[model samples]
Target: MTVDRRPGGVLELRGVAGGYGGATVVRDLDLTVGSGEALAVLGASGSGKTTVLRMIAGLHPVSAGRILVDGRRVDPLPAQHRGIGLVPQQGALFPHLSVAKNVGFGLVPVDPLARWRSRRERAARVREVLDLVGLADRADDRPSRLSGGQQQRVALARALAPGSGLILLDEPFSALDAALRGRVRAEVSALLAESGATSVLVTHDRA
Candidate 1:
């Protein structure tokens, strides 16, 4: 398949073959996520959907082929160097940090004046992303005070705050109540579109 290169297209998997040591789960999976596009990797349980996300996030190694972001081959690069964002199913928020801090955590450890922007700038960016996901008012709240849905939004905001071109979500909304799934999905889709981020969402249901 011909992969289209767009300015913001953040991720491409070509002939990706990967799985646990002895067994292969995904083979020759050719996929491309374009700029601002949200592509769902739909498969049944144990069909290797999550494995694909893990491979993209560098949590798993590729046995063959390549993973590219921004036209650069990233299979050889380390996870942090790939500039990829991941929002796992559990939200994985830091219990000790406030919502704002959790969202801005990825910005920490950068030189204050180097890769880092001003604290106000970072806060503003965090606020902007939180607001996009409808969590601006909860910035000062801890993860413990938020509902599961709210926590999921916070996790998404955190992932987006780093301005990563691509986000890989591994069943991020699975914990929410069925009634809330649609709302969360809609919000996430809109936020990704507005940010011009290419995203890969792994879901079990084919529908």
Candidate 2:
């Protein structure tokens, strides 16, 4: 696979803390992920691993601390404007959309330069990321037609289509079978490295 280089993938979380209503599940979390690096946050169920990712992705409010991407504080921005990609558990591919459309969702309106303003540009980008994920042949298929692992790849392609600097994966491979889960996780890790996107994977799996 050909690698594409881009600027601004560094991620930093300083004294980050958050939780539901009155309780704090995560507190004082500080970490930095340089461009092209992958960090795994391992925890058991209900251990606040997903909360950390949500805080960074801006889905959950941060009760304390700051989140920065390439030295820019993104905690203040909305989820779509944060320039961070997220692959949630079970892939979360839309059943109504084709693989190509699923991957192209983020490329629309999220790019600061509006580089994918045209349909042709967006299609090309979707195809490029699909190829990266080895799903070029399944572009026309619906999410329901794909296997669990393929759906996860499509979810990843969606997250990557906009070329987000940092990727947050919340147990993305949990729905796959044991054998498939290992294979997909390795492929995802390699793809993130090749793409040079800083990544944080929160999962119960230690392997």
- State the local distance difference test value for candidate 1: 0.82
- TM-score (all chains, Cα) for each model: 0.89, 0.94
Displacement of the residue 163 alpha carbon in candidate 1, Å: 0.6
Clashing pairs in 2: none
TM-score of 2: 0.94
In TM-score terms, candidate 1 sits at: 0.89
lDDT of 2 at 201: 93
Poorest 10 consecutive residues of model 2 by lDDT? 1-10
Q: Which one wins on lDDT? A: 2
1-207: candidate 1 lDDT, tens digit per residue: 111122345578999999886899989989877777789988888989999998888888999999998789998876776778899998999999999999999876444443337788677778778877877789999999998878888988887777777888989888888888888877778777766778999998554
- Whole-model lDDT, model 2: 0.87
Cα error, residue 193 of model 1, in Å, equals 1.5
Worst 10 residues of 1 by lDDT: 1-10
